[model samples]
Target: MDLSALFSLMGKVALITGASKGIGLSIAEIFAAAGAKVVISSRKQDALDEMAGQLRARGYEVTGIACNVGNMADLEDLVKKTVDLYGTIDILVNNAASNPVFGPVHDTSLEAYDKIMEVNVKAPFHLMKLCFPYLRESSNASVINISSIGGISPEPGLGIYSVSKAALISMTKVFAKEWGDHKIRVNAICPGLIKTKFSEALWSNDKIMAHMMKALAIKRVGTSEEIGAAALYLASPASSYTTGTVLTADGGFTI
Candidate 1:
């Protein structure tokens, strides 16, 4: 295989949710740079507009669509809009997630658990179903779910979120197996302790950061860009024949 061709995302139309900032935005940026026409979404239109404008100025093909993934109507509209503008959805990145509860599983309220499951687990499932037609049309279809290391191993004060993520991993496998015949590759990316606003609780604390330094083989935290690169690999032809796999980019933290 030609080295450039293996990783090129040219002509692909990618829809990435929770893409205004953090891991989602990083993946969208990288996808656009790799030649994919990317449609990015977040709960806020202004933020999405800003991100899209910045990426376009860099000579990348991008569009901003504000959609709260928690709502099925929003998800349906997100897929419809993508297809309307791009003709098809070649890639779907279910990166939008919620972690509302920060207590023991036993102490978590029903409301908190519902919100966590709604955004982190249920949203992705519905989004995939909504985009199934468009994804089926693309010969190079791919779905990248942004799971977490917490899913693989429980995290203190993040019990509910971890459970949702664990469900997402299972969902990835289920879809990958079922969609294999359709040639729609599905996978999950488990990022570990990335230094983003979403993970500030862990990286921002001096004591927590100190402990993480000694725990990780790299002696440092990971970045959203690192996870984005991993997404690119799974999204591109370079990862052809790879599906139903959980690619953990955790700075050897799991080891």
Candidate 2:
């Protein structure tokens, strides 16, 4: 088998949300390196522009579009601007997420719960719908949702976030089944204890780190780059036959 050819994303256009840092940025970097025209999105324009400029300097076709996924208008503009630039979207990655409250599920406020769902679940749902037309037109369309292991097994202090992620997982399956006819593949990735700012609360704590290390088969925290590679596989032709799948890159923490 031609490995390079299998994983190649040449001539593809990918729109990735929350891509200014961490897992999202890693995925954008990998995709661009694989020859995809990448559009990275986040809330801050400066951050997105800086990252996009850096990638472009590396000889990749990259653009930055700032968007707050929680806002429907922002999402609409995101899709519009992306399509206006690239003409089509071959891969869509819903990586932007929020978990404002870090306490018991019962302790979370209604406002926090709404924010969590809006960003983590609703944003992805709406973005997919907006991109459906372009995605369906692509010869190899793929959607990769950045879910979490918490969605599979809820962790303490991240209750509402876990619920949102679980909802995302279900949404991935739903889209996969519904869009299969159009040859659009939808899949979810469940990363565990990644060393990202979003997960700093867990990985930065000595007590939590010690407990996590004991459970992880890899014996250490996972990296954003590792999750990026997993996403590359799902986005590339290598995973053409894969859809409605939950790919776990948790370093065996679930074991």
Top candidate when judged by lDDT against the true structure? 2
Q: For model 1, what is the C-alpha lDDT against the true structure? A: 0.93
lDDT of 1 at 108: 92
Write one digit per residue (lDDT tens) for candidate 1, span 1-255.
Answer: 588888999999999999999999999999999999999999999999999999999999999999999989999888888889989999999999988767678999999999999999999999999889889889799999999988899877889899999999999999999999999999999999998898988888898788778878987888899999999999999998999999999999878
Clashing pairs in 1: none
lDDT of 2 by residue, 1-255 (tens): 899989999999999999999999999999999999999999999999999999999999999999999999999999999989989999999999998998788999999999999999999999999999999999999999999999999998899899999999999999999999999999999999999999999988898888888888998888999999999999999999999999999999887
User: Ten residues in a row with the worst lDDT in model 2?
Assistant: 204-213
Candidate 2 wrongly placed segments (more than 4 Å): none
| lDDT, candidate 1, at 255 | 87
- Alpha carbon lDDT of each predicted model: 0.93, 0.96
